[model samples]
Target: MKSVLQQLPESVLAQILENAFQWFVVVDKNSRILYINEDYCQFLEVPRDQAIGKPVDEVIENTKMHEVIKSGMAHQASPHYIKGTYMLANRVPLIVDGEIVGAFGSVVFRDMNDWKKLSSHVRTTMDKINMTSHEAPNKLYRLEDIKGSSKAIRSIKETIQMIAPSDLSVLIEGESGTGKELFAQSIHERSERAEFPFVKINCAAIPEDLLELEIFGANIEPEKHHRKGRFELADNGTLFLDEIGAMPLTIQAKLLRAIQEGEIEPIGSNMTKQVNVRILAATNRPLEHLIEQGKFREDLYYRIQAITLRIPPLRERMEDFTELANTFLQQYILKAGKRRLVLSSRTREYLQNYHWPGNVRELQNVIQAAVYLAEHEIIEPTALPEQLKQVRKKPVTQFVNLQDAIEDLEKMMIQHALQDEKDKRIIAKQLGLSRSTLYEKIKKYNL
Candidate 1:
């Protein structure tokens, strides 16, 4: 006897499955996507071709297909969050001749209205609870919040995923506005300490006199009220120390002892307390240079940098500029209660040409300002900040004389050849010029 699936034609079977389930996907034993229906691809906003052959988790957020494959257990009517909605999904291991070969998954929302009604009810219940609750939820950034598809961004995200599961101390290095704090939050969110409090303190922002008290709380002199320090407050959690390079040498020694011993002694107290805390430190300045100058402790630097994650500056990842700019523009537009606005070609050109010294933060500020300044649907160059408009890639100077143009081209070629080849003979040979002529041109152009 043939089963119903076997009885039906392949095309007919595929069509039935595609229409029956709102989203469907299949992954191999290795957890690489083998097949995904068009509906699922459309819902994910990823092209079917692009999604195929990728890891299931990379393609679908919060997917359990891999777990299904691993455990060979079927999950029915499980709530899975995708994008912004909670979906009822089913996952089952695919078996052939009593051997598990892969996994099959589907999100079943037979009636859109039914899902909408359920969602509305859940939202109302949550709203009521939130209104009565005194404690507010912590605003911690997740891995997805670090937006960018550039190679550098992807590499950093992959590193975070690999390191976040461990209790290793991480040193995040980047420019002033490269979203170091966001990355720190992402690490905490992905770590085992996610449910615990995530404490943060700026070493540069606090005064030296009170810095010790801030990190290791002080007992009140008159009342002797015992206050919890950041280390104690973040016990069994994560503490992010921003601008760690600016920490005074006096405090650096204490920090080293605390990290090394997993203990801290509060100010005005002789007793020491043990706390299980994961430390994540960040600095815009090079700690090595500071160490050479005797401003930072080398021992402390070694302790914190169990792993280092360097965030690329915005200027280095210009490929992501348009997407980032648009994201910020939309965010500010919604805040201002305005309709959709897009950057004009000229405005984009100006933004792309300028060197973003302040990095992602500066780009966000620029877009926020443009959102309000834009009079129409399109943001013109005039809507951008004055500095961005003024500091553009210098326009190519036009050559008037043929001799001058030839000399300019020769100089550029010789400079590039010299950079590639250290030997003058090799450079001359590469540039197809005589050694004497190359030397003359090099002296003339001052290469």
Candidate 2:
């Protein structure tokens, strides 16, 4: 009996092969190139004519594919990371009757945009929830979207990546709106239990008596049907407890019991039910301070803080300020149905000087509010918050780095020069630097 593929006509087979995503190629037993698809050549950044006569090794830079062909074994390969981009390819030996006939392979480039699309789809479909806005895909949180380029932020991301797949408990510490929950979700999404439910409960939102019942489930009388709590719902998955510091000291004992003993006894029921749940907790308050004040239990703290991660605030990582500002601007402009707007030179200066006490969430809200209020195409100083407009003249000796201090002085001088002359060339000549150098310094300091 012949397979359906083998039963097809030559023309039909040719059309099916041409339209396929996986590029196919055939090589003779002697390892000479015989036939190749248009994509196969295109993937290698070579012409079809150039690829047809060349051997697999000659066409492809990596010899892995060629080795698989000669060995008469099928090979599966993922994106070959090159120049900060992932590229994928696969090679398989073609067998006919009892003889090794030839080899075939396929290749494709895995761009950042494509990965974002795939990640968004996976996040949406697996969670069956609205993880992000429908308008943009790349806006979904990544290591780059964390609003920080500091070594601390990079270290936090690296730690999360290392522990995301582990079952150990994680305690994330950060200020309010510093994206602690976002980090928790990223861990859940990357872990082995990604397909399982990710349940979130705010410890501060629930009363002490109700918190236990909410987590450990409650029993109903024989007359009524009962409901299960988050633990049961999130069994074999993950439960993110936000504001863990806000949990009552009394209930903390129960939580410890549940953690130590994998079973939870309901409020009314005497029997304990086993639940397998991974706990990911976050808090803004300092647990050590609470421990000193006798508000937080030290035992429970140690239990939950098997691994701790500190998320840096926006002010600490100023290098990411411009990137985050531009991202939020693009986001809210489309959402608010306003004309495209870019931050003016003055606006950037105002943003850089103003301390972001509210972190990334505050920045997002500011952008949305500014975009909604702006009448012009470009965001001006007037469009900014009132706090930003009140820039105070402070002493400049705070910077320890003299070079940075000099740049700051030069920027202030240039701003003053611009006000008087209104000419960049004149300002450059007066500053005793080239026009290109002046422009470069202006951009570097975001003057």
Candidate 3:
């Protein structure tokens, strides 16, 4: 028996598809448009001839054709925002002979008024719920988003999986830009509270004067308007406190109380509201040292650190370096709407040799810059930043005596440390020397 498509002529079938769907498009496995109906071309204000062979994303605003092709999954009645209005769209992979060849997609709604009516009804229903004006931050990352396969990363992932089911407080410690927040989000996503809001606040970013109001909510002096704090917003969910070390000692006491009692008193309100919030705190600095220095509260430290996950810096996991670099490279390449590009062997060598002082975040920035600077399909050392270009393999040196060799090594170490760290105290601490001894060594070495 012949199928309907097989029985119909090619031109008739094309016309039927063009008129039947409000808007339709088809893209090959590479996300390059293979066929686009006349209606979609007219809507995009592009000629049919010009639309074909171009990337779907370039022609259609916020199109998921590429994602459908990549995932080989179908998106049915998904809300798609185009221009200024939201429309339902369906995207499905086009398979032939058990192989996905491309993707076929179309807008589901033919009448704009119908969609507007539905959208308005949904918004009205949401408004009735009295959702907070200050929306909870979206949990944009998952464990898969961590993007590393090193033993260190794998062990941390395993630990997160094991601890996610429990309600224990998690203290994530890592250097700045090591993706502590990503791990926090992953834990929330894997937990029982995954359906609830994953609220986050950066202690250092918020002003100290306003920080209390931000966390504990407040009633405006003149307006008498009551606002919900992060604690209330994160009720029955996870609250991620980023840069926890930077939280003021004054606020620390209240935070400890909330964690212990499961209640929060708004700034102006006399009554305390009960909230069930799972706390997940992250810090780039050593909280223990801060406690000793009378900066961070010791009790708060013990409260938040029921389970600790320490993320190793990029330098410590060199095995995942190339993979991470390539991942970032691909992301930037797609963002720039450019063809596929690869890092040259020499470029990779330079990248691996350089000490990533800024960690993963720094590497991502470097890759983004290199993607735009690259003139060819390959990213060479020339495309890297000036500092990265200056990085070179150290040469073997011969010394006259052991003392001379030791002194040279000491001087070299100091030079590298100076370049890596901006704080002299941190450098001294890392080198196992006191501030005075480090200064004397620096002066003696003329570093």
Compared with the true structure, model 2 gives a TM-score of 0.59
Q: Per-residue lDDT for 342 in model 2?
A: 69
TM-scores vs. true structure, each candidate: 0.62, 0.59, 0.61
* Between candidates 1 and 3, the TM-score winner: 1
Q: List the residue pairs that clash in candidate 1.
A: none
What is the per-residue lDDT of model 2 for residues 1-447, given as tens digits with 9 covering 90 to 100?
379878899989777777785466677776667877764553443445556767666766544556665687776644443212234556788788967777776654333334335555443432332232243322223343354434566678788889989999999999997889888888887788877888899999998778987887878788535569888898999999999999887778888898899888777787889999999999999999999999999999998899999888787766566657766775665445443576778887888777778988888898888887787887888888899777754334354567645654665676567546745688889999898887676554433
Task: Name the weakest run of 10 consecutive residues (lDDT summed) in model 3.
Answer: 125-134
Better of 1 and 2 by TM-score: 1
Q: Compute the lDDT for candidate 2.
A: 0.72
Writing each residue's lDDT as its tens digit, candidate 3 over 126-165 gives 3443354235344357786676655578789999999998
Q: What ranges in model 1 sit over 4 Å off?
A: 1-136, 394-447
Q: Considering summed lDDT, which 10 consecutive residues are worst modelled in model 2?
A: 132-141
Candidate 3 accuracy as lDDT: 0.82
